[model samples]
Target: MTYPEIKRFHSNMLESITSHASQSPVYQDLETISDIARLSQLPLTTSTQIQNSFDRLGVEKVLLAPIARFWYTSGSTGKPKNVYYGKRDLDDIATGFFQLLYLCGARPWNNAWVVTAAGGETLFGLVVEKYGLDGTISPLAGEMDMIKALRHASRLHKIDIIVTTTWLYLLINKIAKEPKEFERLVETEVKKKVKIPVFSTIVTKYLLRGINYTRLGGSLQNAKIGFSHAEALSPYLAKIREAYPNLEMHDVFGAAEQWVQAIQVSPEKDWLSFFLRYSIPEIAPPEEVIKGKEDRNYRVKGVPWYEWKKGLKGELILTRPNECLPLVRYPTGDLIEVMDPAFSFEVNLERGKMKITLPAIKALGRAADSVDFAGADESGNFLGFKVYSRQVSDALMTIRNVRWWELYHVKGSPGKFVFLIIPENNVSDETAFKDELLRSLVNMFQEFTAAAQARAFLVGGTAAMEDQKNYLELMITRPTAYELIDTEIKQRIKEGRSVGQLKPKRIFVVDSDEALSTLTRKKMEA
Candidate 1:
């Protein structure tokens, strides 16, 4: 579709949704907005509003009607928000997934292993059937270990494509790289008689044998392509490339509230191209939405995707009028960088040749994951700056002997950051490991110092710029063995209830020093 055609469709969708706004108590005030220009004038819908009126935001009697399915957010920061869909909404979402799969190099006859959570099964089923692909849905829930499932599926069938989250992909890569360590971990669990389904002696033997077989080219070798979503992929892209040298990787962007929105088409291209048919894309400046005044409401203005220029960074706003619970200018809480105003791609399908042109963007970490800190200048004036989860993750990924880590910032104390880490068992030199971590922290802080210095030079003189330095303090401590065991047991229990339950909470904020201390304690008395 041409740019003008896409704009017209967006305007038409806005008008259609407005006509139905009176039926929804949450959106009744939007009934008067008739066009895209007018729709931009209203405040962006916050997730809190949607959560507060979850059952009353859609069409009239939506709950009374037969709904297709209900989806939920990960609730990493707060309570999970719920959104219901009708049959039509499912159909639209399936269509979007179909296109996304095609862009990810999926063919009709190829066998695909789709590893996803509960809410996405029906949509993937539709895509598989409609596109004539042989697909299997491996629920992230239950007693089934996802890594074991992938190995068994690859052995049983010639799996060509694997779909899963970025975290899962990283975990798989880590296990693949160190099969012996994985075996030891599982052996420890077995010795302790952990009541997890995946820890059975029979399953453990099979999993170990499968890992060995894969080293000789048995599992995941047939799979030529992969699709990773549900988390930011940029921070770990280099690691993924090093691990899976032959596997073609594609990063997808979307949320539970809105199904698939954009996809990365090629490794040569650094941005994800939006699926214009599904929603109207918009960008809201970070200052107006997330990093603004202390008393400012979350609501902020947005610029339509077409008007966005290259290098613009902000929170992504989306308007999906076609959904059953139509979202009018919704704040998705995801940070993004607009890479190109117009990115074009041409593909040849069985039917004919097609060309797609749309705005391309890069998904940064979530806005909520960013923490702002301040330091007093030479004149006793406070200068503020922000740190992002991606920066910290990227720095940590460069360090050796690190298994998993979480960053916490105390709400009232912005200058101090706490890290709770679980290092690899091979890390025997604790002091050396800590020294390496501190080096990485210093390198990350240097980048911020340079940026702050430039800002200070612009605002004041060279003296103020020279005074700009790192003010952040790092508190790094390894989790005690008791705490590690407790966390692992809890995670396994949660996994029995849902897929993607093992995904880590990498970054968050605490209200008090007690909370931070509790999480970052190095030793616990039994």
Candidate 2:
């Protein structure tokens, strides 16, 4: 914890930012935050602001240069916004990632089974793969839909560790539980002339199910760890633990703009420790986020990392000024709660001051956006409970083996929302799966439904109109949601409706018949 780099980070960041051509509105009156108290008074910046002010926010020299990587956010509507980073920025990113890997007990001898696209232009996947060259990497399919990628990975050497998204890990977990079924799956998918069921089962059993498989002179099950990134792991942690009790799981937190911001210090805890050396971190209460929704002009004031109290909930704000695209007071839209100090470690801040480690934080869901759904009243009200896409998507994806899914609200429709789900391939009990899915959905929206019913009663009307019969419309679909989205994206690009990199989103709200028709065209055509 006594790393000298930590002390120099703050001063270095301020100097680098101030030296830039500060033409942006965000930096019009800005100078320095050397005084930590002054940092609290600055207005918080949201992603929407960055998207809207991209032209005005750029430092001319950096924007015109070719030495930068442009990444985009996967927003629900419209064209995605781009985030730029320079070569030095990528180096810093690698350093941060290396620190996290080291903390997770990763060594040069480790072999990683990575579930990510091998040739795609995904920003996070590219960065992780680049920095992770300290060890061997065997790229697996990020989704079951990528049959060729999966087949290629199945033929790789034995794995010492596995790194993937929560959804893909669940798919692997399901396959590992049934080696015979997995054998049949590989035989069918690879399209080989000969059947290798026994061989397939042996490979799967040793690579996925057996604890005695050797790695680095230790049991592979004990040596092999799993890391889930860019999403919450809490929703799927218990199920993963039940399937592979010996596997150590780690959760990582980051975004497109600021890659690898924080990582879980230990496998035993849910909280994350921030990489303070890479970025300046801050937080504001839930009330600030709610207030900003009512007024777009209002900017919330945030407390610096040093000022956050244990148990306090707020969104993460970061200042990474050394990048090609500098972000100051950037609101990441992710909600997190500060946790009590997990351990004690002393460090020097280079200003003749000694400080202990910062408090850990647990990620809550993202800040809620005001979304009008099918169950809303005629006046576009949904009782008193505020509904957000993150809330519904997070709740629905908690169901077992759910890979890609979405909830859509059709305009002109009352008391109904379409829940389109794509379960993993091996889910056999359709009835039970649907029932469990409905149960989870109902549990998620129970409060909103109860409030709606109470409002109806007070108005001398029964709650029959808003009952489950009227509201719940579930569909288990053939094509994965990602496939449909990718098709749309490709079509859009071909028609010149989009340019540069585009990010596909999982959940969306369509306001017109034409837009809705486009999404359902695949089913209609079939």
- What's the TM-score of every candidate structure? 0.80, 0.65
User: Candidate 1's residue-wise lDDT over 374-477, tens digit each?
Assistant: 44532122246566776787777656556566777665421346665566454577777777887887687776667667777887889877655434444444
List model 2 lDDT by residue over 245-334, tens digit each.
Answer: 677888887776776777775665666777677778778765675565445556667877666678776677787764455676677777
Error of 1 at 26 (Å): 2.7
Q: Candidate 1, residue 37: CA error in Å?
A: 1.7
- The number of residue pairs in model 1 that clash at the backbone is 1
Predicted structure 2, TM vs. truth: 0.65
lDDT of 1: 0.66
> Where is model 1 poorest over a 10-residue stretch in terms of lDDT?
374-383
Best by lDDT: 1
Clashes of each: 1, 0
> Clashing residue pairs, candidate 1?
140-499
